[model samples]
Target chain A: MIQMNPSMRAAGWLLTFAVVVAGAVPWFLWGSSQLIGGLPLWLWWHIGWMIVATAIFAAFTRHGWDRYLGGIDA
Target chain B: MPNPALLSGGLSTAATSVELLVVVGYLLVALLVGLVAYRLTGTDAEDYYLASRSIGTLVLLFTTFATLLSAFTFFAGPNLAYRQGPEWILVMGTMDGILFAILWYLIGYKQWLIGQQHGYVTLPEMLGDRFGSTRLRGLVAGVSLFWLFPYVMLQQMGAGEALVGLTDGAVPYWGGAALITVFMILYVGLAGMRGVAWTDTIQGLFMLGVIWIAVAWVLSAVGGPAVAAAGLDANNPTFLALGSSFYTPQYIISTAVVIAFGVTMFPQINQRFFVAESAAVLKRSFALWPVLVLLLFVPAFLLGTWAAGLGISVPEGANVLPVLLGEYTPGWFAALVIAGAMAAMMSSSDSMLLSGSSYFTRDLYRPFVEPAVTADREGWLARGGVVAFATGTFLTSLTRPGTLIQVGSTAFGGFAQLTLPVMVALYWPNTTRRGMLAGIGGSQLLYLSHVFVPTVPVDIGGTTISLFARTYGGWDVALAGMALGAALTIGVSWVTTAGVDEAAERFAVGAD
Candidate 1:
């Protein structure tokens, strides 16, 4: 079992929620059939969002992971 | 340049033979890897089951990647994209990619921590130990096995479909399904987790390489992505846009949520949470998971969507990947890609059978049938369980109950039903055994009712609602069950007397 400060945990969850919602659906891009880079704009939104997700996950694992494991900061 | 005869399942004898040979060669390599891993395996249960908890970052990452992306990714993913549109990418690639990574950290990382501390090998064992209840452990194992059986069968179904398509029906569906079943039982029964992981790593890498090559080759052959997109816009304009009859907001949200939670409960994947050698290894794997998902899913699903614009004719209920490859790529290259698809299926099946055997022996058999079982004897029993379980799934697969996507989604829903209870048990100290059992058992029943019973429409405020519908108001029935399960778990815990507070304290953060 491991623990982290309540404030840190809340912030981590908020970040996760934001990322999840960001990629959940491209509501604003719907009905736009414009193509960029040989793919639909909506499709590109998903692709770019996926890259952003990858970056967020990388940052989370690198920085917040120790706090999750109940390290010195905790 | 497209060969209509080949697309219609009429390949020359030489072409069929060459493709069959390539598939056979791939299977042989997997078997040889199994043999080597068997030689390296230690005698004890931990050594056999968890690979002595020493899997490195790449192996752990690929094994998890390969195990999760099965025949579904190779076949059903593209098939859906071909039928519905590229929005399948949002459901599988973008949303699920991110959601699953988050869960891997929240659920998997915590499981790893507790596993290391208590030396727990199975989810049921951990839950049972925490709540001090053997029946709850056995119940969890039963529910897990119930759902896992269909998923294992799904891989066999995929193998059957892939081979039949690649060989143009020169190989019967039964023959292809039977072939993977026999090999899976042999290696998984013999080598355990070490062998499964080793082969999974090979299969994972092979699948990725072959799919990427197929994508690049197909793109060049179709005169590049720009031309393909133009063709799609001219031919199937609906596909290029979103907000279709199927890709509704609720549909995307529910499917992504269901798959994310469901994947964590899969015996094959859940057990991997305990296999990472260190916190660094686990962190590295989860961090890389979404990227790996995008790499495979985008290409696979995009190829399916592209096939529609290429005017590729697909037979009823057939996967579009093999047909697309056969049209653009040469015989040998297409065969190699099909072999890679087989690799995807085999990787998933082997891991499922390996982890399932552990659940059977440790959680179900040891506690109920033989509490004093030796490590060596338990190891033998687990091997036997693998053989028996594989045989059962193979027999059921011969019936060919549903399409790859249908069967796979049903299994995912079943497993998703277990997630809320497991999560509650893991985090909440007040979660009673009764609450856990009610949550798991109640959710499973609700989910099964939706699956088994026919839908009946009832009028509510002039709006007709279909009871027992697989998807009501675009939301999947699995989410409804999960909502109920969550409610039962939390609601029941608050009112019930806590009998396992002492046992549960061990799982509390910072507790000694």
Candidate 2:
């Protein structure tokens, strides 16, 4: 019901996918250092994932989605 | 005579007496603001808890910024940085700021916008609307209470320790503790949200100004942050860097993930989304928060570096800021630094006390017990809740804290675990209430087990991990808990009744 421009929706979903995949990469690939720029690489990885999380969650806020999805009268 | 360290650092009788004045002064100022601000805040429940939704951009911005800058940055950042090295500034603090911006400016700001349109009042209210379940609302409220109490205690301890150091025994632990507690309880109790916001604005400004001065003093004394870091790293390379490449990859990646996503989920922050007058204001507020957060803690890190260079012992951990302030500068300037640290402590304490009260009065009390309760009565309850919660927090702080900062991180991580399912279900109508419960319960179980068990070691494996485990060495507990919770919520939510909040989800998830 919540519609994004094909671009934003696609981008949003893509970012979400990236977050999931990046998070899971640990199951397969591991970094050599606990510190990346002074932190553990996993934490560094989470920082990257957080960006994806925020963007995807924020998509829920875009007004056009509510309107395009027919949730609002307007 | 005081211990050599104390004596060498100018922790004398006269100086200590003056410190007491600053401690008492902070409480007096808070009470004055509470008494004066009460009139402006109105007597209704809305005014008391939500300021009748009239908080301005300037005040709201500062309060929001202030609340997010917890002991993590104010004291922990520099303490850890100094103890470890400058890499944390780049790794931990930078990551923290980045993650914070994503949540506050991105996720949090947008939520504020959406809330304005939907008339969302509380976190559970928002979740309840999305899932259409009274039970979920109650569950989240319960989660908030379980974790919030310990956090409130940590803040009180932070404030109390700073007070103790400043007073140098002229004021007992309880004296400084009682002062801030009474101030927070009275201000939030009497003036409600408006008063808290106003004081937070003042408190925020005071803290920032003080931090800048403190940083300058430290830099002036030690030549600067770069020099300070270089000074320490020259001596101990192992403590400053990842000891081996073994844990490096997993540590950085996991910490970054946890901090970034885990931060915005703090309930105190969730409450802010509902309080915003508009999304635009909230966004602007968040935009400023990153730098503010950076500045607040960077100096502490640099100070830690400076302290280690001087071979200073950061006793009680919470006293890291004051001990540095008192010793690093002249008497007059040290008092100012002391004042600023007080401001930082109070800004956070006041906000949490108010937020905890909101949880009790809004999320827990009014909804489950009496849906028909008047707004005024509900507000009165919140005010009283502030006093009650503050008392509990004070009592908890009396015992010495081993890892004050870690306690905060663990509690915050537990809350972040809830963010996924709760936020997702708002848009994805197919997310079942059962999924929410299952995910949250599973995650919490894992976390509690860690609390009871010892899955990871502290101080040895990772400093950040140590920061979360407190004494138990359970940083892994939180990480595992969050990861499990997120996965289970989605996996479980998908299998159960497709919780499609057709109207809300249609806009949220685009899966309708």
Candidate 3:
């Protein structure tokens, strides 16, 4: 079983928090009506950010799974 | 969000008949799935309630996916996107997608462990046992059922409205709702979690396929993606931009937080925490969750936004999806998509009824009404409860008390009130039973006051203050309730002893 250390846990959570905040609303693209690939830039940002969020979640689950379940052998 | 009234003129008789046939066929498939699941289901509570704890990756993922994306996703999401802007995607897709996945780990993984250890079936059961309070257990169950009632009705209401829109009022609203209600009672009564999960997997896949098809076809009819984007840009530029009147930072965050946390407490969803066959299954499901969410939400919300670009004019209180599809897609194709919408509603409703029955039996009835009930009798009572609860929610749907978003959001807030206390009880060994009750009871009261009571404005000096405002400083009632719940839980526990009990000690031991 892979046990994530405290610092590693903190870093994982902090990185997730950062990604969530960044994707919550595209602050940088706020009020910008520019189009990207026919969709709004902000909408595209969300699409791109969702991909990023999915990657981050996949990584967290891979690395931090034991932190929560803690070697529970189901 | 699609009003039956606007659905009156679009479909021909043949189209209406085809759509009705497709919907009826879908319901039949659901019943058949239930029959198979019933045959496979064991006589014990564990098998009926949690599928014998043997569900694998695909079924678990899709069941959770289908259960969460209900009529709200099918109707309200698009309606909001069409009316407001694409920012609705931020709430449903981006923020909620990520937040709920994280919560699925933080809350669900822990619950999975405890449930495995204790043979727990419901959230309240776990919490009540951990705190050694029957009253607290009942309170949590009561809160969950209370909120679940509205959400279940929301699905029925969506069904009625969607059907009325598809058949152009050939199916009356009551008839549409009755169709789903009767079918749900039959299937959910016949098959428990196993049936619901299997059917949910089908429904989830069907919904995903139908939405993507609808989007692809509509984009083609409306001159493709670039044309649709240009049309939206020319017609409703505000939709393309951020900082609209409705999609404020506060609004987005608060809505996302409420839904993400509140979903964890939903009787239907909470019960799912215990259904995974293995830790690896749970891990895979949560990891894939965000991707699945985006796959559906983007198309659903984007379709609504594109309707604005295509110059689709929707009346107030009506959904844009059916209108958009009716305009751009073939009759058979439109009918097929409406069937997909029905699939979404049924998937959600069946799961809700199944889990609500478990909560009623395991958490409420078994403990409070029948202490020595046999396992077989308990299963029968749960099935009966499914019928009664579905019938009750169906009748409530006939009254049409609120819009999909209105009732759904309120229920989300109500469930959000339970999150903090449950978290504390799960992780904190010093959490007292009294504190649990106070936290849940008080926070619920606070949240309900905001939901039920009309706001009153009072003049204080020169500034006006609105009492019971739903949102304060951008944070909504759900967040407010959670803060108070957490505060009271921690504060009350600090001053009170946990007593000499094994409940708290059980969780304090190192995880296996």
DockQ leader:
3
TM-score of chain A of 1: 0.66
* Overall local distance difference test of candidate 3: 0.83
Docking tier of model 3: it is medium
- State how far residue B237 of model 3 sits from its true place (Å): 2.3
lDDT of each: 0.84, 0.61, 0.83
Q: Give the TM-score of candidate 1.
A: 0.94
lDDT of 1 by residue, B1-512 (tens): 32434432465687787787787777778888889999999978888889999999999998888898788888988989888889888888644578788788778988888898899988999898888889899999999999999999998888888888887777788878888898788778778788888888888888888889998999998889999998898888889887788888888788888988999999999999999998889888877776788788888999999999889888764578988998999988998888877866886898898889889999999999999999879878888888888889889999989988899999999999998888887878789888887898889999999999999999999999999999977889999899899889888888887773338865755321
Tens-digit lDDT track for model 3 on B1-512? 23223333344566676667777776787789889989988878888889988989999999988898788888988988888888888888754678888888778888888888788888888887887778888999888999999999998888888876766667788888888888887878888889889988988888898899998898877777889888887888777887787888888888988988999999889999998999899988877877788889989999999998888987544467877888888877887787777776887888888888888988899899989999879878888888888889999889989788888999999999999998888888788988888899889999999988999998989998888999877678789899999999988988988755537855652343
Work out the TM-score per prediction: 0.94, 0.79, 0.94
Ten contiguous residues minimizing lDDT sum, candidate 2 chain B: B466-475
Chain B vs. true chain B: TM-score per candidate: 0.95, 0.85, 0.95
Residue A74's lDDT in candidate 3: 32
lDDT of 3 by residue, A7-74 (tens): 77778688776767556568887788887777777777777777787777788777667754556433
Candidate 2's iRMSD = 8.1
Question: Which segments of candidate 2 are over 4 A away from where they belong?
Answer: A1-74, B1-12, B91-95, B167-174, B224-230, B238-249, B316-318, B454-475, B498-512
Q: Scored by Cα lDDT, where does model 1 land?
A: 0.84
Instruction: Evaluate residue B58 in candidate 3 and report its C-alpha lDDT on the 0 to 100 scale.
Output: 100
TM-score of 2: 0.79
C-alpha lDDT of residue B346 in model 2: 64
